[model samples]
Target chain A: MNAIEIKNLNKSYQNGLKALENINLSVKKGEIFALLGPNGAGKSTLINIICGITKKSSGQIRVFGRDNEADYKKTRSMIGLVPQEIATDSFERVINTLRFSRGLFNKPSSDRYLDSVLNSLELSHKKSNQIRTLSGGMKRRVMIAKALSHEPNILFLDEPTAGVDVALRKTLWSYLNNLKKQGVTIFLTTHYIEEAENIADRIGVINNGKIIIIEYKKKLLKKFGEKKLIFTINRKNKSINTINSIIKKYELKQKGNKITFNYTQNSKKDPASDLLSELNKRSIRFQDLEIKKNNLEEIFINLVQK
Target chain B: MNIRGIKAIYNFEMSRTFRTITQSIASPVLSTILYFIVFGSAIGSRINDIDGLNYSSFLVPGLVMLTILNQSISNSSFGIYFPKFSGTIYEILSAPISPFEITCGYVLAAASKSVLVGIIILATSSFFIELSIIHPFWMIFLLILISLTFSLFGFIIGIWADDFQKIQLIPSFIITPLTFLGGSFYSINMLPEFWQKVSYFNPIVYLVSAFRWSFYGNSDVNIKISIFAIFFFLGLCLVLISMIFRSGYKIKT
Candidate 1:
């Protein structure tokens, strides 16, 4: 069964703003799904709805085939959420906060489990430290530790590494991957595409309160990922007229010294190879040649812009 | 019922109380003792006995009730308000715990602390004044009821308040004054016939009267009306809390 299934989810604020519309999604158990969106794209709203923090205006949500609202106690107990904001009881000790979270989720006290979680996060030494005494990055890690204290099957991280340093972010990503290997289903929303690229098995793009695409990370890269071929001609002004026919035929873009052609990975024809051989046949000398494949960031930008 | 969840919140709140022991326990207890020294001695020296009871002894129940009302509201208000203010409320709201369980956790903790303070005040008051409870069971019952009622009211205030000023607004401007004028130190019969009728308008008068009845059995108003008033206020707070949770008031969304 899917870990989370959202059907026709809609949320409208009292201020007449529509936050989410017709959101239909399902996250398979034991998979890592990353949600990518710009600010105010309803990513957090969707997570909040599923977590039962924000009440949905209309729709049905099911967790493991049980209705989320009707079986909220069971559903919420199974899911853990690390919110975007680093808000915790500053006066509370790190260990006490985790204990409180576990108890709040109706989990039995397991100091061994909590200590393991802290050790994994490298927070064992700071267990007795008050949250306010920790650095910003340490505090973020504390939030993650608190979320995992209940040993939930499903975890939702909303922009987990928004302002975190690169080193801590990488550490967190590795920890999340470790959680995934334990058969935990992870759902995360992030503006950092690199984090998603490195960790997410599937990616969902949301724009303007609507989901534009949801596909396997590999499939998305193959489908929308573009490969650009650039050729730097030996003499641009002299070769322009000679290569004008070829450039027009292949729809290439000409700059001061180079002509570039773009194609997707799944293209039927080998346009880059054909263009190279065609240029050689015509004896068009070039100084440099380069092929570049677009990463998830570029594809994400294109999709959102569209 | 999510008993563990309720316990987690209850323990969290109680720990906070102990952590700030000076403000939570010492301050109130000391203030109540000071009230005894000033009001009990200074004023008791001037006034004769009313209804055949010494002025200091007569002031015991009213003093305890005053402490319960103030402490209950302050404790419960700060308990919920700090969470909402700090953004930690998301954990509580998103947890498996129901609204009823959440209310029980906070209200019970607040009432427990208030009752402890009331008991402490009674213990200390015995050192100075000759005191007796005409109905010990009724006194205990009224103590718990008043604490729960005011704690619920304070929970509403915590949810309603957006800033610290608003949190202090009701207790300082409304509740404290009402308690002082509600006959905490003096019986309403001492006032003129018109003033006695006016005192009925203050709900604190009913609470004080009923609580005092449990002590000297010298109630200024009927016990039944006071009982009804307590339940009515408790019900109103409950209804408002239900509405707040339903509407996702300040705590959610």
Candidate 2:
């Protein structure tokens, strides 16, 4: 069964600003789905709607095949949400926060489970300490502990590492990957494209309250991925017009003594190979040749710009 | 019926109360004793008795009701408002617990705090004045009922308020004045005939009169009318809270 299914979901604020538009999405069980978007792109709004924090203007949502609104208790019980803000009771003890969250979900008291969650997050030592006394990164980990306290089947993290240092962010990514291995479906939104590249099984890009694209990490990379072939020409004696034909045909760019050609990596035509031979046939000599593959960050920028 | 969910919020609020014990318990107890020393001696000297009851003894029930009313409203309001201000309310809203369960948790915790304070005030007053309860059962019943009602009312205020000042606004400006004018230190009979009629319009008058009757077996308002007034207010608070939850007002949105 799908971990989450949202269809025809639309949300608009009272001021008539549309927050989400016809959002149709599904996250498979036990897979990590990362939503990538710039600020004000409705990524958090969508997650909040699914977690039952923000009321949807109109929509249908199902968690494990049950309508989320109609069966809120069942749906919400199956999900754990780590919100974007690190908002916690400052004076509350770490262990007590976990206990409170676990109890709020109506789960039976299980010190064993709570203790394990604390240990896994490296917060066992700080369990008795007040939340305010913890470092910023540790406090964030505490938020994760609270979300996991209920032992939910699905987890939603909104900008989980927005302000963490690189090393701590990597640790969080590893922890999330471990949860995914445990058969927990993980859904998250992030501004860091590499975060998604490293951990997400599937990636969805949203912009202006609309989902621009959603695809598997490998497939999305192959589909939009581009390769650039650059040739430094020894055009000392050859007519510049001789290379104009190749430039016009392959839509290449010429700068000084170098000509550049761009094409998708997965395309049927091997434009790089064809252009190399054409350069030889035309007697357009070259000193050096280099090929480069565009990364996900470039593709994301291209997609959002489009 | 998320009993554990209710218990979680209840424990959380109660722990906060204990954490600020000086403010929650000590401050009120001190104020109640001061009221006795000052009013019991200063005003007790001026007014000897009212309707055959010693002036100092007569202040007990009204004083208890005053503490319950103010503490109940402030405790519950601050309980819910702090979560909103700190942004932790998102966790509660997203949890599996229903609105009814959430209400029960906060209101019960607030009422429990106020009731405890009320009892302590009564005990302390006994040291200074010869306090008696003609109907201990009714006194206890009225104490709980009043606490629950005002706590629920304060819950509404917490939801309605956007800033910290607004949370204190209603309890300070509305509740405290009504209690003072409702015969907390003096019976409404001391007022002229027209002023007595005006005092009956204040809901706190009904609460204090019934509470006083439980202690002295005498009251300015009919016992049945006071009881009905309390239930009516309780119903009003419940309806307002239900509407707030249903509409996803300040808390959910």
Q: Specify the highest-TM-score model's number.
A: 2
Model 1 misplaced stretches (Cα beyond 4 Å): A235-240
lDDT (tens digit, per residue) of candidate 1 on B43-148: 7878799878888888888899889999999999999999989988889987999998999999999999999999989989989987788999999999999999
Model 2 TM-score? 0.97
lDDT (Cα, tens digit) per residue for candidate 2, span A1-306:
899999999999999999999999999999999999999999999999999889999989999999989999999999999999999999999999999999999999898999999999899999999999999999999999999999999999999999999999999999999999999999999999999999999999999999999999999988998989988988574677877877899999988877888987555777778888888888888899899888889989999999
Which residue runs does candidate 2 get wrong by more than 4 Å?
A234-241, A281-285
**Model 1 lDDT tens row, A1-306:** 899999999999989999999999999999999999999999999999999888898999999899988999999999999999999999999999999999999999999999999999999999999999999999999999989999999999999998999999999999998999999999999999998899999999999899999999999998998999987888744566668898888899988777889976455877778888988888888999899989999999999999
Clashing pairs for model 2 are none
Question: Model 2 fnat?
Answer: 0.88
Give Cα-based local distance difference scores for all models.
Answer: 0.92, 0.93
